[model samples]
Target: MACLIKGVYIAEIDRQENRREDKQIAPTWWEAFHFKCIKVLEDDVDSSIFGAVFEYMGHQIESPKYVIAIRGTMIKSRTAIRDVYMDAKIALNELSHSSRCELALEAVEGIIGSTHHTNVWLAGHSLGASIALQTGRDMAKRGYYLETYLFNPPFLRLPLEKIKCRKIKDGIRFMQSFVKAGVSLVRKKTEEYDPFILLNSWIP
Candidate 1:
């Protein structure tokens, strides 16, 4: 599945470089698995292909009917700044407010509406993973659980796992839990948006 997602990245790079024939990644590589590119979602900021939708034409029982793969941050590229901006948004817990996230959710909803939710899968990496995670949560809230794979999703907190002392790590964990509980309580009482509560029914 990761290979198929990587094909999307390669296809975008080839598209940018004008590579074709045997060098093309979309039809050339995906055809091996009987998947065809159905749609290419572009970044509105730089017009770069950020997501690709692939439809499975094979009769294999394990194959997903459709797969939406989202590319992660491309370092040193034109979309890098926008990607980093989204990364910051994740850290700020504002990813749901991103236009790109909205686009991804809309795409997934369109597919699920046209076909069936059980036949679709979502996969993403890094910043794209954040988008995918948020989109999955949104779909789950709507009572549609789509299989999702997220690679290297960002964790918006200090790396407590790096701390050598167990006591300090436990202390930090306790404080973090306490703060989170307090925030959840406040949000619930105020009827504010609480994704954790909304995501209670989603496991993946």
Candidate 2:
């Protein structure tokens, strides 16, 4: 799972960098696994958040999987700054809801509406992780089961006292349990390069 998350993160970076260059770079490990970018989700209303949907062709499974990967803060524009503010507001429970997260969820729903898939997975790093978690819960409410893989998530100490919504609190609790289980699954010590350390280095 850690390896998969790292591949997704690298792929996202590649996709962003490639957008600026004239010639596209070669595909990364995630793309090598037959994960092709199907849509890039960005709009005027939700300018703060950016995400991409990739269609993965399963080698063994009969059905395909859809993976939605979101990009974290880059400090490249006003929208990026707004998204960073949203992350802080969400952590402190200053806002009633997160618009950026909702936008990402809407993008996922749009993609899912167009195709049939076996399962949907969400992944992101830093601020993107928060959006992914919030989006996952929203999808859950809409009768969609989504598996999420978050890398180096911020706002670990979100103030529960500031949160007024009981449903939102419940969603946070569910996310905590889900993350804890994922951590347990990948707790084994390894002599190889640690993805956690790599993720930390990437974060500022």
Candidate 3:
């Protein structure tokens, strides 16, 4: 799902670079995944698309109903200015107050409220990951826990991995093992049966 989201980002870049809508790759790529591009989200600053919402069309049991994918900072693109500004806001711990965060949060909420028994997923990378993380946290606080996937998310505090102290690293690792075990047990008890098999009707 992360890969698919990234593909949409790449296609958007391609679309902007060539200044042609037909050159976009998202449609073909999404078709392969049995998903349809339902919305292309634009940033308030430049009106350049920075996120996408895909609606699943496949008949796979338990597949997500919608996916909200956000693209990270692009150093050289139409959205570079907005992206860099958002990055700086993140560094300064002002992401929650930013419009980007609000936009993502609204998109996810819309999907959740649009229908009953909906399965929505969220994914983002780098700057986008920060937005996704914030959105997820906000949703959880509101009693809505959506499945979220983050790639290369920024850490506000000093990363533990970069610390030179072995004791701190070892202690963190030990605690992580315990946390993982507890999470595994919880998943086993609450998980629904999902075979992940796709229906033949949707195949090309």
Candidate 4:
């Protein structure tokens, strides 16, 4: 799998295929020992070849045991502030948008649910961070001990407002650090796809 965003992926292999890959076809216990060290969450599975310029924004490697939902482009959502981006408002509108969070929550409940979790971490990069923040808020309302990591969420609003949202900021820096290291190693080992060149800026 090749991902533009480092640890995240587009999910190429179906569940059945993944199972097959995990357990190789072997004769019997007498057969030669063979093992496959496979990492399903490699960068090769990411969405953009032009992923984060700041690889330090998102998650590192998520475990199957944990229900992790990552929102990609929340900027596309039709929020009340959609027109704020018009003309010179492109930057401001992006900051005020909340509709993307709605989509992210729906996706999380729809895809990552079914199995319950006491601790669920929702994360996103760039504009998606805002969505993650919103999702975390909703998850909290549902009584889930949700932790959200927003990677360089573009805060085009008043500095005070963005600062106010910092509680949800939670593991922003930590998440970026964790993911950046993973992306670097993956890129170095030829294990997965490359990350966005801008990742370094956010990591620091």
List the global CA lDDT of all models.
0.82, 0.63, 0.76, 0.39
After superposing candidate 1, which stretches have Cα over 4 Å from the reference?
20-23, 159-174, 180-194
Per-residue CA lDDT of candidate 1, range 50-93, in tens?
Answer: 88889999999988999988888876566678878878898899
Best-performing candidate as measured by TM-score: 1
Q: Report lDDT (Cα) of residue 177, candidate 2.
A: 95
- Across 1-204, the per-residue lDDT of candidate 4 in tens digits comes to 012222332222222134353353311211222211122221222222111111112244442233343324422223213322221233544432333344456555653465554334455665445555556655654555455566665554334446555655655657767988997787777633333332222221
Count of backbone collisions in candidate 2: 0
Candidate rank order under lDDT: 1, 3, 2, 4
Worst 10 residues of 2 by lDDT: 195-204
Instruction: Please give, for residues 33-108, the per-residue lDDT of candidate 2 as tens digits.
Output: 7777666666345343266677776674842477887766666544556666766776687523766666777777
Which residue pairs of candidate 3 clash?
A: none
- Candidate topping lDDT: 1
Estimate the TM-score of every prediction: 0.83, 0.58, 0.73, 0.36
- What is the full ranking by TM-score, best candidate first? 1, 3, 2, 4
Candidate 3 residues lying further than 4 Å off, grouped into runs, are 159-204
